[model samples]
Target: MAEKTGNAFDLNLFKRLLKFTRPYKLVFYFVAIAAILLSGLAVVRPLILQNIIDRAIIPKEEELLLYFVSLMLVALVAEVIFQFLFVYFANWLGQHVIRDIRIKLFNHMVGFKKQYFDKSAVGRLVTRAVSDIETIASIFSEGLFMIISDLLKMIVILGYMFYQSWRLTLFVLLVLPLILYATRVFQKKMKAAFEEVRTQVSNLNSFVQERITGMKIVQLFTREEKEYTNFKQINEKHKKGWIRTVWYNSIFFPIAEMSSSITIGLIVWFGGLQAAQGGVITLGIVVAFIELSQMLFRPLRQIADKFNTLQMGMVAANRVFAILDTKSAIQNNGTIKLEQVEGNIQFNNVRFSYIEAEEVLKGVTMNVNAGETIAIVGATGAGKSTIVNLLSRFYEINSGSILIDGTDIKDIELKSLRSHIALVLQDVFLFADTILNNITLGDPSISEEDVKQAAKEIGIHDFIMSLPNNYLYNVKERGAMLSSGQRQLISFLRAYVTNPGVLILDEATSSVDSYSEQLIQQATEKITEGRTSIVIAHRLATIRNADKIIVMDAGQIVEQGNHQELLQIEGGYYRNLYEVQFVSGIE
Candidate 1:
């Protein structure tokens, strides 16, 4: 929930991130060892060059010169070997750590309560799962280990400079103030810039994802220009955030480069003057100091950039951990496992709401024996859908209990409870996959033959056969290849294949044509036989044959009876509803 991490370096968040490396500790240790070895090797090259210049080139001893040259070659080869190990293992450790974190994050998200998803953006979640996690990987590869290696190199270089000549080392120290001040200011500013950039990236993703998903609404309403303008504004904000970091980099690097150059120039000037005046300074010392100054300054420059990477990883970790810390999952404390669930259901004074102080289902009570079909009918917002939602335990009731058979639903395990129930909604969602896969939903027990048999039983086999590849035909996303009525049929067949003990259809036949309606009617009759079924319908005529019709108004059951038995009551709710639907012929 924090807008940003604590500072450029948040040790707490960094430690939390490093926890992912516990599973790969061997790789972590190897990368650490390689960093130390590379630091040792780094000092060798500069020292060899200094020895070669003063001992071999200046003294004119052929055999000593050859001996020093060969030693320099060996040092160069060793440096290459350790450098390769350091880079490769650091990256390898990063990738493994991120893989473990990504999987754990996704698994945690899957268990969150449905209300959490209802209030959150899918695109924002995608950013956390995909791009933000990718950023955290750099904490290992380029941020942590890389920065450690560079700092070790700088330490060795500074130590060497002091040993060679304390005077030249003091000259190098003069430029440190300017460079250090610039680095401090740069890190603070760049950390803020990267935070802004991450926020804007998440916004950009959310805007694009929503607009693309609802493209039909935009074009149908002829608001494409308005949406395009909105997108441009979001994209511009994202660009500005990134450009601010670029602006900081452009200013900081030049100052660092200038400081480095000034230090080298000062080294040569001071060393040569002292050497001319019969001091300890020599030509080899001057040359070696020049090389050592770059060696120290280059890593200092890289550490700033790597620290920027580390800061970004921290920001991303803070955001990702916010979601992972949410405790909105439904409490599943039931230890009772249902080997079989009878279809009896009862709601005893159930009260609930999606939002606080705005009750949707108010003190409702209902009961149904096993193997009965009940139809619920009401105007919109009459808690028709809420009843079924509670029965399935999708939302916990504010007060009272829902019982499946005789046991409280909260006492039954969730998987075992849901396995006996199948829900078909008016809005059917199908993945972009084959018709067979959509029906079976890749359930290992439901084979292709099972799907075909289910389709035949539901009487939609011929319709599926009319498609290009029959059951193998691709339905595209959300079943876009199928008409609304055809999608309803697929949903019915999907429910049928499950062989659930209780089937609840919510407004399933309200939007279909007469021909599809007839097919659905036949399928419903076949599927609901000998199973407890609850049908919520807007078209009052469809449920005339229900064993019991429960009339609900606002949030309570107003009437309950057989269709004709309720129709006999004078000026009753169901009586008026039935007349209104048949007289107007529209719902």
Candidate 2:
């Protein structure tokens, strides 16, 4: 089970949740009208029964009997019609409300900073998006209407019962105080149990997602048994949550039923004595009163059940609001567009840290001419990739000014800055989509020929063409259907088509094999021509031919020169990396 740490109910959150339904106000009113009509019909039915017994059925007056029978039938049919209308409108309103909420939440979440993803689990977010929304939707559609109907029914029934006989009504209403007290206590307990259920379900969802996404790793490590055991433990916790929920419901219902029976028995004994004492109430009125008492309790039972459902829905609403309320760490200027640029980049006294204890890049400064290829090479964690991230503004510098064409990057609009740079990473991620759509990123304006040319430039044109469907071939989630090398080639093609002024290749060719690497090397050369590029590679030979090589270590620049000049130094970090590369039999 996912750990239950956060509170779900806040008035401000509920207010926001209600705003999502404001658009469907008219339909909600229609549903409310239907419920009111239905409640009134329920009250009239018992009185109609009392009338039929005293005036029609007992006296054997055929005309009165037929008239009363017709009235009862009309009421019954009207009740059914209103019930359908009530359900239909509520369902319509609920679906649209949830749809609005999900869209708003989704848009908000995607805009959140990288730090949010770093802190929260993917599985938990997925639950908020999918399962939590579903639960809330159900509650809005059915639970809300049922509660309204039950409450209205309870009021109407009690009012009529009291008018009939105040003494007996008081006796029946006496049990209600105790029921209300028990309901309050049980509701608190039920809410806690339901909260646990929500947590466990989220945890189970995370576990399943982790296992499925990392199935290859699990199989390779032979940890299936361990995963199974962990899953079983979480499943048991989930079961216990359900068990508590059931225990509460089971005990509460029987107690409610017993209390209801006590109320009914009291009415029967007291009403019989009144009838025996030459009271105005008839036997039929007594019978109707008995039925009316049952009617009162029936709606009460439904109200209780609906109340539980409302609690669950509120929990889900709280979670959904929690996500919507989160502020993205990466702030963007209000501007919508950025001016065109020549792509001259500068970093002045830049320092950055992903964590407090360790700085990734420290006191680094560099300048890139409009169209120069700057290759960054060093051992892993030497701040090479960190420089790429900083340049792209994925992570803001702790202290520094990164300027594009002399304008501080912070001043330039975020989307505009990103549009100028196309980043191709080593770990390629692809959605389940056609190759063409993946390359174009669902932009319908891009021509098919352009996509193909980009693929050919990346030297993956032949591989794609060899497939029966060619560019129409579907790539599975994360490109599971394609090899790592093929996915990388597709990503390279995607960046090529964008034709951005600044290109970033962060270990871009690291995952491909030797044969694929050679093709990538040639393709990289073609694509990097006349484009400002930052290449972060462990392969020293890949960057040896660049215009400049920047060697970084411990967030600081330790060496800066052409590869040949760095190689001339016998003992520098670049020289040592170069020696290791050549000794490892890499070209």
Candidate 3:
């Protein structure tokens, strides 16, 4: 990413943001036309006021006065209509553009590689998708189009001021150079401040989100005071960032107001002298000049404020585009499809790492025939889980190949490959939803009957039915309402309902009570009966009946055999692991 600088307007970034509006170009153009018409109408009101004061009122002609008054009313009504159109269309365009961009950003994020998320902050991404995108919408609703309309209004008013009396116009413009210089300095300062504010907002969001998500850890460690102090520091930084913008505004606006006041004073003093000196200055012209001068300076003040909005929006666009532009590390170039895979899996000299030069899986080779059950046993960080992760293609292997039915998994289409496999992780994650919905996961094709059947097969139907709402019972967030055992049962039902050809249970029974483990083992047997199953378990007792047992140590397979055959080999890795677990009962 390029370093952010103090540029009030980034043309390239603005142009890129405009591409999202292309689909709504007709509405966008209509908004533009409305802005122009509104500016024209703004000038007409001042002219009508000038005509009434100079021609109709001063002449004491009641008929002409009524006629001019009627004309002025018509102009005022027309201005109101155009103003409504301007506000309505500008906001309408902004909403449509933001909707399109938000969808695009979401789609881009969904396709990002797992590695990208590994290093990214969830809170920061949420801020980009929600808060930052909202800021971009203001670039149209309250920034770009508003600024343009104000500028056009100012130009039309200036033209009228000069037309009325050049001498008075010159006097009124004397204080403008000071205002212009102040505006330039203000823009540069506010741009830097707004950028800092955005960064701090994102930081504050990240800190709060992470702390809340891990609140249990905070309470367990009794670190609430420490986390609160840290949060205060982040919030203070955010406060300071916003205060800087306020400070600039506090300084700039008063200067602008004082300059505007001085200009009005100069116009009255000079125009009065011209009238006394027998020049062509009239009461109506002087009155019109006052209105025109206010019109001219009002937009100048607003431009400074609107320009700040525009700058903040450009900064937000830069952050969002940064995510959109990132390329996923895992490429999906395979086109091959499978009607049904036989579930024969092979890992041929597979070597992999989550990070470079920090190998997690060394050159490992393994094979399983169709419909066989294989259990992988290992200590923590011994690459047992990594093996299953590679099988699912969640992360790419560093060397060699992983294959199903003798075809390299890299050659298989990602969606089709993943469709045949179901993974039940040790840490079960259930959405805040009903039991039936959690099991089916919003898959319309998976009927409620199918879910109930799957739950019955897994021995969880009675437990679910014991609840007040039965299958309709809500699990709440991350299944907090359910016990660890209940959540595991739900996950099993979910995996079973999918009817996957291959099942992966990654330490699924390790965290549950003995009764829950028995139930899980029963569910495991039914699910793994006709499928190729790979179970990664730290509890050695859970995999005793495996058709084949593979012992892993330090990212390499050290032993391979059935449970009894491995236990017979004295001091073998599998024997040692089994003795350490079942004999000591410390697992």
Give me the candidate number with maximum TM-score. Answer: 3
For model 3, the stretches where C-alpha displacement exceeds 4 angstroms are 1-5
Number of backbone-clashing residue pairs for each candidate, in the order shown: 0, 1, 0
Model 1: per-residue lDDT, tens digit, 1-587? 43455478987777788888888888899999999888878878778788888888888878888888899899888888888888888888888888888898898898777778889999999999999999998998899998999989888888888998998999999998888889889999999999999999999999999999899999999999999999999999999999999999999999999999999889888998987787888888888889888988888899999999988988888989888888877778877877766689898999999999889998988888898999999889999998988888777889998888889989888878888899999999999999898988888999888888888888999999999999999999889999999999999999999899889999999899999999999999989988999999988777889999999999988999999999998999999987887876655
What lDDT score goes with residue 138 in model 1? 90
For all predicted structures, in order, the TM-scores are 0.97, 0.96, 0.97
What are the per-residue Cα lDDT tens digits for candidate 2 across 1-587? 11233343345555666788788888878888888888888877788888888888889888998898899899889888888888888888888988888898898997777767887889999999998998887676767788888888889988888788888888888898878877777778878988899999999999999899999999999999999999999999999999999999898899889988998898889888888787976766787888888888887777777777877888888788778778764677726455566779899999888788577877899988888888887767888877877777777789989988888888777878888888999999998988888899977767899988777766778989987699998987988889888888888888889888899999998778877787788779888988888888887768888888988877778888898899898799988887777977764
lDDT of 1 at 58: 83
Clashing pairs in 3: none
lDDT of candidate 3 over 1-587, digit per residue (tens): 42355578888888888888898889889888888887887777678777888788888878888888898889889888888888888888888888898999998888777778999999999999999999998999989999999988878877877888888999888988999999999999999999899999999999999998899999999999999999999999999999999999999999999999898898888887876686899877877888888888889999999999999988898898888888864677778887787899999999999999999999999999999999998889999999988898888899999999988988888888988999999999999999999988888999999888888887888988999799999889999998998899889999999999889999999889888888999999999988999999888778889999999999999999999999899789888877877788776
- Model 1, runs deviating above 4 Å: 1-3
| Between candidates 1 and 2, the lDDT winner | 1
Off by over 4 Å in 2: 1-10, 334-336, 583-587
* Span of ten consecutive residues with least summed lDDT in model 1: 1-10
Please give the distance, in angstroms, between residue 115's alpha carbon in candidate 3 and its true position after superposition: 1.6
